[model samples]
Target: MARASDVFTEGDADLKVLEVKSWLKSRGVRDFEPVSLFADQLTKDTVAAIEKLADTCTANKSSSAIKKAIVKGIPRQAVLKPSHAVYRLQNQRFALGDRVTMVQDSGGVPLSVKGVVIGLNTKSIDVVWDVPFMSGVTIGDRCSEYRGSTVEFDSCLNLTNPQFVASTNPKAPATSIPNTPFKPRSGPYPAVRPAPGHIGASGFRPAPARFVVSSLDLINSVL
Candidate 1:
């Protein structure tokens, strides 16, 4: 396996033998000899010193003061430009129903307005603000109805205390009918009469004809 000093040297070429000796001296490693004379002792001490430096660097990098220093060292051009149109197109994090706050100057004073995104186009976004800014206007009035309310997508900034608006499309109520138990037929008293010369259960039978004797006796009495 490669020694720790070898790994450290691979990262930083400025850490020379003299700097390593100085680091060891600061860490209370006395009686330092040349690596040619005491190779094993010098190598062990150098590794320990490099390890200590690495730990110190890590701790310093994590500190807020060192972090500020590192940030200040970075060029202004390296910072992300949120106002760029191309950057806004590439990283479109907002959508319809997302609440956004826009910072603008009104009457030479900075004003912050919170609104919901109602529409989106190629170059701009239409927002409907919840709070009414105009005079004689009631609360919950849409801001887009007023002039100069539309904001460019690049100029808009996401609010820190973001509250996502719910969808306007409501779910339709169910119209399904419930199933009912089957009911039997009721109130039936009629009996079916069979036709004449119809076959009975025993055998087939002929129907009887009516008598005509009363008409002849009545005619003889009248004569």
Candidate 2:
């Protein structure tokens, strides 16, 4: 008859030494010296020794039950270290001008606040939110506008949940303001001759007045 340890070794191929230690600790199995000594290579003899030790710890539980307990003691993937989380965030390459959404009240109710990535540090990111802080604001207030202000990554939302919107460049055509007229030229090599009244004594035309559009106006137009 195959022993319970043999069944476990064949069935759970991914089992590790740490998991064995965790399982022993969870069950208060104090006689762990033999198991710990041969943790790297848990042969049939080692497993039999461990089974004997486990029997002394819990008289009522069967070897199969001990196997189940060990399986249950496996650490979850989500239980990550702080440094690992930060390393993951750093690998994302979140740069300035990247648009990101901050998720608030994620557990009970989710609220997504839009912001632009303005700065980055070793430990956190700096975001300029499209809205200001307000009292009693909830998920329903996502569309509500406020005076734009900056916030730290940790303060605004969990670093793990920052949803990427779009990365932008100041010189990118998509981000450039529209409806700004081009200035005419007046020199001998001018691309386009200046209009009759706009010509200067130096034979160069002055640049046209730039029409700056407010961000609020842009948003309102889209709506």
* The candidate that achieves the highest lDDT relative to the unseen native structure: 1
Structure candidate 1, residue pairs in collision: none
Clashes of each: 0, 0
Candidate 2 matches the true fold with a TM-score of 0.22
Off by over 4 Å in 1: 1-92, 106-110, 135-148, 160-223
Per-candidate TM vs. native? Answer: 0.25, 0.22
lDDT of 1 by residue, 1-223 (tens): 6655665756554456568779888987775433322111113343334335444554566445643333344433333344442342233345655566654443211255555554454455555554434531211222222322455654555563322222323443332322332121122222233566565544445657776679889899899
Per-residue lDDT for 1-223 in model 2, tens only?
Answer: 6545664665553465458768988998864433222112223343334334434544665666644333343233323333343332222444455566554343221246655454344444444444445531222221223323333343342343343222233343332222332122222354454577666446655688999999999999999
The C-alpha stretches of model 2 lying farther than 4 A from their native spots are 1-91, 106-110, 135-223
